[model samples]
Target: MNKVPITVITGMIGAGKTKISNRLIHGIKGSNCKVQVLVYYPDTITVVEDISTKRQYRKLPHQEQPAKLITTQEQLISEMISYSKEKQPIDELIIELAAGIPPQFFVEELFQSLEKDMLDKTFYIQSIVSVIDAQHFWFDYTSNHYVIYTNDNDRMEHTFAEVMISQIEFCSHIVINKCNFISKESLDETVSFIKKLQPKAQIIFSADGQVASQTFHSVNDVDLHQIKSNIGWKLELKNNSSTLNLVEKFGINSFIYESHSPIQLEKLEEWFRTFPSEILRSAGYLRTYSEAHGLELLYFSQVGASVIIETVDEHCTDTTARSKVVFFGFDLKDVEVTQQLNQCLMENNNINQTVV
Candidate 1:
């Protein structure tokens, strides 16, 4: 049986992991390689559309980003591969995990369960990757997130920063996203900080979550248990230090604001012009009332003090007609931010009930 290479992508909630997954698979679509992509979101593993295929994308409403749910990992690796004697072959596979789930969980599980000769010989891990949000690295991560866990060994309180850095430490590659949003000097410091944590991992800077074709070929084995056995918190403390001081000294935090109400694009943009300076990054898909553009939804994202909103409904834009923007940084009172965002919402009677 020919071995199928698997690449595991993991990171924080908004670390560009999904975008990178789309790009990696899209880049390999036309190649001779036969590959399958599996994205493990919070609840289910979905087989997404081949965003590279224009025809498939055009079929979507407003040609918005195409996303499809897939069968579970058990189906692909065990049920399908175990019958390899009768099944057709798959050359490569990519698995993107849900936020907060570590990559090592899948790695250790596969090795333990795939011991049967059929799967043992056929399935192989290709690479592990973690995406980092460059602009928020300094002001959002650290403090209570890791400090709480460092003091108490409770995974329940594990911070996004802790989970994110662990993903980076265990992976073969680290992709620092939104590099263009920060100054070159700050980017250098971010890279240096990541280097101190994962010295051997390959670190790539990405302006928009795109990487070279060669990044997909790297396969590095990380011994998560071995690290746990030796040094332990001594090394783990470094991970906390990387982003802890920033959050502690700066006194900032992040949370997502999701509203099903359609927003007037013009009003939203106008508001962003004078939006609170505390917002480190705000990204989400929203509906626009403008009939001239014929666009039902638009994507808005602000990194640090800069906003990058696009009208294009390509695969890169994952925002829905409803908005779910993330606000990260300091001096943002929940009530004030919520009130300000509410003001940007459209006054129309139309309602999107997809919200909780």
Candidate 2:
């Protein structure tokens, strides 16, 4: 039918999610579709008067920030309703979620909360797409830390890693941007990483934030119940997206990997090199059995094709005595990953078993 297709763009903070949103907006200008955007803007960050001023790669028509960032769920629904009721028809609705919030919530809860007939008649979810930062995201993956700050997470309690991983786990398509900084070998490694994590998700490599025209095509409908966890919407009954509610469905499941003993560097790298494809993302801290060169802890975060490891100082507030990691993906076997990781732990500790 002729329902409006809504596309959501999500990713880690400063991961170029906004730039992708802008590209989509400008890309649809002359396509004969009436499109409107509702972007999330937290109160703390300074709002740019013209969000598109910096997008100078191509000549875009009058693209500007539609409204200040949307804060409350109520506001999001209210504004979207207004768009549907407007005199000029809007065939497409594009939403850009702030880094802290998961786009899964708005697409699942917001639509489900509204009258079924109203949503089916007016709006259908086109797709949920995530943008990843090539450099910073790699750093987050390797350093085992995401720069998601308190100001962003205040709206929700999800950690930066949780926020980023959820995006990778749930989205139908993943856009890895800012590839200019990495070498060809690193880029190949990055692609290999993502392919393992989400073999099903369409991977798009973009130097800039722009996607090819084909990626913007719309989907017919969004059936929540029948669709299952294809979009990683676990425990939709809850108002928020929490990993505690994660379940196995649509080929995806998550488990925590914890070890008391430190991991051997060579073994850990080997495990990473042989990471399972069914696993989409792994983020956590890795501790070496013995402190070396004043370094004891390494932060690790990997999504699909990117793996990042950041060295942690001894004085850091986070402990480096043990390795704690979280794994999320489709068709994953908890036993398999744990067993491989167990081989990486200090062989002498006698604590070879990893808690999953």
Candidate 3:
């Protein structure tokens, strides 16, 4: 039976993964192959639109930025399954996750979803291909890599390199992308790095995502043993403080604030509404009204803020891990701003509680 091939494309924030994916998708579609690429964040769509417009305004410059669309990871995978069921002779389905996200999340969330659907069908994941950024080999990466954009400091650490390494560790193929941006010496260094990470990966050097079109001509049938051997079921993070290292690159003026104290919901909202310019991104588990009710995850990205609410299992003893928040951005090290936020958290006593 003919099967659909799914490739999970992962990399760092500015590591050129999206660009490569876009180019590949467009190039494949231009060919006889039915190809589709998926993105997981709306912000990425905006970036693509902006870049496309910029390129057009620049009279179609040397780099014709490809179109990118952002959809949820689960939604993308589900769509792929549905599309495959129709017996569409598609060549490739590339799913691009946001930078700094753990691959295990992709495996458990997207892969498992596909697997569950496959229980009644023959759809299966064919390969996992990771894209690496050659230029910024020494930088750090995190989920907040591009959430806060700063000027004058280019050496910021992002979880990109680590994510690339993780993708290589668990995938069948690794594409060392953006070689054109690196020198011969840097190119050698990058290859050396990948060799130590995943020595067995089919490494490819891509120029503008052009892979001779023969790369996707053959689809490797799922080798469960090989997949399991490449991907460790138990995902342990060896580098926890890499984010801290990344933030320190911007002059090391960063601190995380945590308090069990109740915050006046309105005041906290107001502060964020007028939050200072230096604050890049802030995320954490927070108790809304009382410690007894349960907690919610507070997420603040460039787009906006959201509170992901779920029933907190009370049996868990890790309170500090919950009932906590972290703020990272530029000029956040100001004594006045930190003191002001601390005072706000402390002073808000009687709040019209919104249980989130």
Which is the leading candidate under lDDT?
Answer: 2
lDDT of each: 0.58, 0.63, 0.51
Poorest 10 consecutive residues by lDDT, candidate 2: 233-242
Q: What are the per-residue Cα lDDT tens digits for candidate 2 across 149-211? A: 345447223345556666776667789898887887667666655543444567888887777
How close is every model to the real structure, measured as TM-score? Answer: 0.52, 0.57, 0.49
Q: Rank the candidates by lDDT, best first.
A: 2, 1, 3
- Using TM-score as the measure, name the better of candidate 1 and candidate 2: 2
lDDT of residue 42 for candidate 2: 47
lDDT of 1 by residue, 128-231 (tens): 78788887775445323221211134323344454555675577778999899899877876665565455567778898778765685844434545543322
Model 3 lDDT on a 0 to 1 scale? 0.51
State the RMSD for candidate 3: 11.1
lDDT of 1 at 175: 90
Model 2: per-residue Cα lDDT at residue 107: 66
Mind giving the per-residue lDDT tens digits that candidate 3 earns over 102-145?
Answer: 45556556656666766224445666667776655444322222
Query: Which sections of candidate 3 miss by over 4 Å?
Result: 42-73, 85-91, 119-122, 141-161, 216-218, 222-356
Whose TM-score is higher: candidate 2's or candidate 3's? Answer: 2
* Lowest lDDT block of 10, candidate 3: 233-242
